[model samples]
Target: MPEHEAGGSLATPAHEVRDFLRRRREQIAQRWADEPLFRTVFTASRDEAVEAGKAVVDALARVADAQQVEDPDAAGFSAVREQLARMGAARSRAGLSNTQVSSELAALWPPAENLLVAESDQASPEELRAWSTTLSVLLGTLRLVAMQTALSETQSLIDRQRLQLLEVATPVIKLWDGIVAVPLIGTLDSARSQVVMETLLNAVVDQHARFAILDITGVPTVDSLVAQHLMKTVAAARLMGAECVVSGIRPAIAQTMVHLGLDLGTVKTRASLADALGHCLHELGTNIVNAAPDGAGRR
Candidate 1:
């Protein structure tokens, strides 16, 4: 007999066990995809989903091995059993429903109780049937719990990716001449403002920029909170020995700034990037003439 076939005979029904586990994984994946809560709560990328599936399968294989082990002291059997128990406890704590557990078990061990009874060589029919039914129910519950955990983990990965996408999609430009321009294109909520601050800070440090420009022409309105965030950014830039120049202040935003009784007294403001550049040049005692109307040309 082939080594694999020989090994199979000494252990649990290996082919049947593997087939059952594969089916269970598929069922769980389908159910997770269909579930409203799961859909709303979790959304993983293709790679993440595949990796999570593999992890679930690997864990299930260990559990299957432990269940098939005849001797308590079989190599690595105790550890496998302990791991399964811990998994059970964790699932229970996670609050997976009993129905979910039963469905998962049905996938893992189709006609599971009957199979358990039929597989036992030593137990009498009555004893095997009883034990089989009880074990089958427990197994089903554990399977559901395990799948729920996998779902949670997959969802976490998706959330992280979503955050990364947000960061990547936001346009933050760093010029070669040590100027970082962050254009606020929409509403500035506290959360987004904080993200802006972090992005600017990291970019400034990474590029070793000596100047930062925050252009808010795209912003529709400004509240006191938004003004405060801008001030905070200015202060943070100062701390890093970088000057912050505010630009693109539309009349409406300017009016809102004044209405809020906010003081941008310490912040340097310019009508446009060109204006800011001119101011920078003037501060450095350089002259530019015959330039574009915005004074973009050399003297």
Candidate 2:
């Protein structure tokens, strides 16, 4: 009941579109449920897709009522922003490109268009054209909102994956009773260094480790930043009642540390992992005596 008269003044485009959406909400939802965007996401049941479509239709109607169809930040979009973002992410995971997703969304208009046309029988051609144009603009804004939210979701996923990779790369191994080690093997940045610190600390507490080893035998280089991170990690371990050993300082890296005036006197240093383990064993009162011939070395 949008007060449409063939010979009288008609309602504004916003009013007309809002009324159209309210009247045809069910039809639009039924049609959109079959589109790729909703169909693939709600495969558990067609009813779920229909419900999601109704939510989006309700949001659009609110936007039209507010005369903010072109505004992506309209209050109406807040309710469905997360839903749209998830849809975008799902489509991306399904290997559909942005253009393909957009095309799928475009398919939703025809059903709504048919409904609009049917309702506009009494509308003059001019009024009908205005209503159609308004609806298109509203749809265009919906596309913008969906794409923006999708990009944000993608970035969030990348950040999470990167953190997971860092955790995998900086694994803490329990080498012996009361002894744990993290064998460093890559370029250490602030982020990865933070991960290393957290992972090492967790291992020390979980393993009740007395000696924590940071073996950098596989590291290619060590600069001031890397040294600083090492020192911080060592300090954190000491605070947790575990003494830290810095091992795998090759000859070249040792010379570089000396030339750069880096002083690591506070940290226990060893040339290799085996040497570090030997030191830990010695501290723990374990001994390995030289073996004589004829297997006489058994204690």
Candidate 3:
């Protein structure tokens, strides 16, 4: 087999990259520790960042040894994926876009290249260029992997936040001793509907309420899907030993329901939240009377 020689040593670009990474792991890590990607993330101490940088160097060495420097899915990357993800996420929290994070990663290249060049002082220009290219490709792949992981983590965070917002928006208010109400104000998708159902049912059991009201005046439109969700929520409340009332059915919404042939016959309906509360009060044997013009109580 033929051999590529650099400084009297037989070494291909891959072999040189592997050897360089192994021989100078400490130096590489120390230098990288000061980079924003590592420094900002491992804030407790400089040593922590240095250690994290060492892990990345080790992973790159493994990739070079395996001759898969260009492969993002190379097994070498598995060890440092979580670490890279954390770094990426931290940069994101610092208001760095993916492009900016990538640029920061690119900044790590010069220090490594300089070290490699110093060690290759006796090597020919062609050999040094080849080694530099190999290292650059490996580091570029690392950037790709980090960005991928960061995007995934960001999406997961967004999903969690959205669910939390839905829960917050669909708050179940205890309107009275034996009545609870959920005032919904937005588009009713399946996810929000599920949240509404779960929250309303929980409130029913917690409050021991006899009546539950779902006010949808703020909901602009109701499709068949929305109707189905509402029916399911009402049925669930009924099973939990509470009667559910649908309120705030505007004339336009009522017309829409009629046109769609959607039935709320099994569910009680009211024109407004005030009317629903009035019905609940009537069922609970409560009464309201007019007060005098003065600040006296009503009889």
lDDT of 3 by residue, 4-57 (tens): 332213347887889999999999999999888888999999999999999999
Which 10-residue window in model 2 sums to the lowest lDDT? 1-10
Ranking by lDDT: 3, 2, 1
Give each model's whole-structure lDDT: 0.60, 0.88, 0.90
- TM-score of every candidate relative to the true structure: 0.45, 0.69, 0.76
Which consecutive 10 residues in model 3 have the weakest lDDT in total?
1-10
**Top candidate by lDDT:** 3
Off by over 4 Å in 3: 1-12, 30-52, 73-75, 121-130, 205-208, 218-221, 239-241, 250-266, 292-299
Query: Candidate order by TM-score, highest to lowest?
Result: 3, 2, 1
Which is better, 1 or 3, measured by TM-score? 3
Between prediction 1 and prediction 2, the one with superior TM-score is 2
In model 1, the Cα lDDT at residue 66 comes to 54
- Alpha-carbon deviation at 290 in model 1, angstroms: 3.9
Clash number for every model?
1, 0, 0
The alpha-carbon deviation from the true structure for residue 76 of candidate 3, after best TM-score superposition, in angstroms, is 3.4
